[model samples]
Target: MARVYISIGSNIDREHYVTAALDALAGWFDEPLISSVYESESVGFDGSPFYNLVVGVDTDLSVAELSARFKQLEADNGRRRDVPKFSPRTLDLDILTYDLEVGRVDGVELPRGEILKNAFVLLPLAEIAPTAVHPVCGECYQVLWQAYDRDQKLWPVDFTWQGRRISQASAR
Candidate 1:
């Protein structure tokens, strides 16, 4: 089985879609290693804030199959393909890493570039897989997060799944 990490986000009906994604993931992949949900300003476009998190799962399915599953899940949740890439989304899921495999495989890039460019991706990834090394950087996630210098901001939000509080919002 390959240890895979996926980044999930939703800007529309944040709680509903986030929870639904979690439910689907649990149902399909059993219990996953989930990171705290974060609220972040939309990066590429003007829109509502997004709830983002990372999920780790071990699967034997090939990368293409896995990507297809995630895309189908998004489509089921009302993802609109007609919208611009930076537009608001009901559900957005992207494969971040598949074990240590580097470069493109099965037409999907391994260790997605967003991991290093976005705080939303890196922070949760560090939280869940701190010791997991980046395929190209050769550094663990926690260290990368510590060294991250971008101004991209994100904060944990109160979130629950399956009757359990899985994330705590910062006290403001």
Candidate 2:
């Protein structure tokens, strides 16, 4: 089985969609290693803030299959194809990394470019996989997070799933 990390975000009905995402992921792949949910200003567009997090799951499915599954799940949760790329979303899911694979695999890019560029992606990834080395950068996630210089705005928010508290808002 390959360990895959997925980034999830929702700006429309944040709490509902995020919970739905976790539920679906758990149902499909097993219990996941989830990161702290973060509330962040939308990037590349002026829209509502988004709740973002990363989830790590083990699956034998190929990259193409995983991407297809995630897209279908997003569609089921009210994701629209008619909107702009960065428009407000009910759900957005992207495969961040698939094991140690790098470059393109099954038509999807491994070690997604946004990992280093988006705080939303990097921070949550670092939280869950601090010791996992980036396939391309040859550095651990914790180190990359420490060196990250992006100016994006994001913060942890109190979140609960399956009757358990998973993330708590920081004293900011």
Candidate 3:
């Protein structure tokens, strides 16, 4: 089974959609390696804050199949294709990496560009897959996070899933 990482986010009814996504993932792939959820102001558009996290799974599915499944999951959770790309979403799921493969595969870019450009993606990714090397940069996620210099801000939030407290908000 190839290791796959996916980034998940939601702004509209954040908790509900996030939980739904996690539930679906668990049901479909058994237990997943999940990262702490972070809340961040919407990027690229004016909207409510989003709850973002990363999930790691081992699967035999091809990149196209995995991407299709994620797209269907988002659509099931009320994601509107007619909406603008930057608009608030009920659920947003993107394939971040499929093993260590680089470049475009099955029409999806491996090691998604957002991993380096967005705090919401990198921070949680580093938390869950710190030792995993980036396909292109050849740096471990933890090291990349340490060297990240962007001002994009985000913080962990108290979040629960399946009767367990999966993430704790910062005490500040």
Candidate 4:
């Protein structure tokens, strides 16, 4: 199984949508490593702030399969692809890193969009997956994340879903 990391965020009914997505992900992957929820100001959009988090899941599914499932989760929670890029969303789940494998889909690379450029994805990612090196950049998340002078808008929240709990043995 490959260990994949995903960045998830939402600006509409964020807490509810994020929790539901987490629950859905647990049904698909092996044990997941969840990060704390962070509220951050919208980056490329002019709308409400967003709640963001990163999750690391060990899965037998291929990257394309996982991405498809994530998109489906977004659609199930009312995400609309027809809208402008960076538009406010009900749920946004992006694959940040998938083990050390890197390749392309539809001629565009994996981690295809600008999801990693935004600190909202990097901050919580650093918090949880600090030592995981960037597959493309070869830099640790903490070093890369802290080097950027991103606005300190992301704040932590205390909401988490059950059932996908990190195991005690795995926690060690």
Residue pairs of candidate 4 with colliding backbone atoms:
none
Clashing pairs in 2: none
Question: How big is the RMSD of model 1?
Answer: 0.7
RMSD (Cα, Å) for all candidates, in order, is: 0.7, 0.7, 0.8, 4.9
Residues 1-172, model 3: lDDT tens digits? 9999999999999999999999988987867999999999999999999999999999899999988998999999899999788899999999999999898999998879999999999999999999999999999999999999999889999999999988999975
lDDT (C-alpha, whole model) for all candidates: 0.95, 0.95, 0.94, 0.77
Query: Higher-lDDT candidate among 1 and 3?
Result: 1
Give each model a TM-score.
Answer: 0.98, 0.98, 0.98, 0.86
- How does residue 16 of candidate 4 score in lDDT? 86
- Candidate 3 steric clashes: 0
Clashing pairs in 3: none
Q: Against the hidden true structure, what lDDT does model 2 obtain?
A: 0.95
Superposed by TM-score, candidate 2 places the C-alpha of residue 19 at a distance from the truth, in angstroms, of: 0.4
Please write out the lDDT profile of model 4 over residues 139-166, one tens digit for every residue: 8889988787855566676574675332
Query: For candidate 1, which ten residues in a row score worst on lDDT?
Result: 163-172
Tens-digit lDDT track of model 1 for 1-172: 9999999999999999999999999988967999999999999998999999999999998999999999999999999999789999999999999999999999998879999999999999999999999999899999999999999878999999999988999975
Model 1 gets an lDDT of: 0.95
